[model samples]
Target: MYDVDTRKRALALVAQGRSLNSVSKEMGISRHAITNWLSRLEPLPRTPPCVRCLESPGIPEDTAAYAYLLGLYLGDGYIISKPKQHYLMITCTASWPGLVDAAEEAMRKVLPWPSVNRLQRAGCVDVKSYTRHWVCLLPQHGPGKKHERPIALEPWQQAIVDAHPWEFIRGLIHSDGCRITNWTTRMVAGERKRYEYPRYLFSNKSDDIRKLFTDALDTVGVEWSTLARGSDPFNISVARKASVALMDAHVGPKY
Candidate 1:
């Protein structure tokens, strides 16, 4: 627990453009507490921290866990900000308990102080946490669908993508992309031959998001093809034997 003076100091530092990570380390306070304190401020200060001040070191620019979570959030998560509170929320199919667990682990690792709750509603599992730093990590948050507006990663997020493309791909495929088997029968030689193969399919309404997904796939040398007609949603797929093998190794069914 911190005193009134300590809380005010923390808020003042944060308002000064200091990162919660750096403030927590220097002032010996948890980022979670710092976030809550800042949220309570009646009038938020507008001064963006000058990096030159060198007080707030900020978060890790690139981490596997962070990269993975970013991809997952981009694919299936959102930010919720209320008058008194804000949070990052991710919902997954209730059937995929393992995926929920994986997302929970990533949140715990990325946030300084992470608290996750598993709520059930309409056969979907909602995993969420309150942390102002989520905005720091995912600046693409705003009104409207990602496709309706613009979607781009910050420089720091790009660094994370550059460092751990496979993990990002894994997260994307696990959350929004999927592996499916296509079967067909054809007459070969004298009799009909039955064949089955696996392919990875990713669907999103946003073109920018589709590009990000395919870019990550390219980073890991996984070949993908776009399958979409005019005025339809964007889709990318990986169907080659070698590519399927690679993706299967990294991404599997969630629970």
Candidate 2:
């Protein structure tokens, strides 16, 4: 076993961005031994049971049962889980052709009511089709009147939104759909401007559903702008693109 001083030193090295392998080597300890010591030294804190469990009678028991079912679905859904993973789970069901509706309904039923509202206020559910499979994503909320800047996306969510297009394109030539692509910073009139909102783009082949999509965008008060004209000559599909531009362009850029 390593001494307390050695453990503290190793932790400090890790805080300074030193690799675990390098830290173990520097401390004259085996990497596996260091990993074991670290795991034993501090275990991750467990999530507390939902507050509803204590406040509402009977609801907790039902919620728990639903959560268990949800966990099973998550384990067997498009994504799988690990043997050692432990987390609270919840499940909901929707019709086959209505995946987006199902996801929203499931989320409403499974999550605490407050959480559902928070998710909706942040951004609505987005549905995308790739390689014949429908993928739906619930976006995070943007900055509001109280907040000076837009909220940042979680790393996992950001990765999914960023990489999905490339992954889809690589898999099939005809695969195209709406995607949230970039978060960019720009300069306007010698002032630095930060735009933290997610940008949505519709591919050329999405013409079939453009009207349906545009109506939804209008309902959300999201204004669309044309970034480019015409379709890719090689693709021979009319690619009409639109963007939200900024979450709070009305607020203007902060100096």
- Per-residue lDDT for 1-255 in model 2, tens only? 668888766654443334567567667977787677667776333323433344542232233223322222222222112232212211212122243343334434433321221112122323211110011121221223212333333454333323332221211111222234355689999998876544444433323233333433444445654454554321222122322333223111111
- What local distance difference test score does each model get? 0.76, 0.34
How high a TM-score does candidate 1 get?
0.76
The candidate maximizing TM-score is: 1
Tell me how far the alpha carbon of residue 228 in candidate 1 is from the true structure, in angstroms, after superposition. Answer: 1.8
Q: Estimate each model's TM-score.
A: 0.76, 0.23
- Pairs in clash, predicted candidate 1: 17-49
List candidate 1 segments past 4 Å from native: 1-57, 229-233
Candidate 2, residue 22: Cα displacement in angstroms equals 13
lDDT of 1 by residue, 1-255 (tens): 789888877776555445578578768999898888777756455444322233654555338888888878888999876443456878888888888898888887776453455667898888886655566667889998877989998776787788888888878776788788988899999899999988889888888888998888888889889887686858888999998889888876557
lDDT of 1 at 210: 87
Residue 246 error for model 1, in Å?
A: 0.9
| Each candidate's clash count | 1, 4
Model 1 residue 44 CA deviation in Å: 19
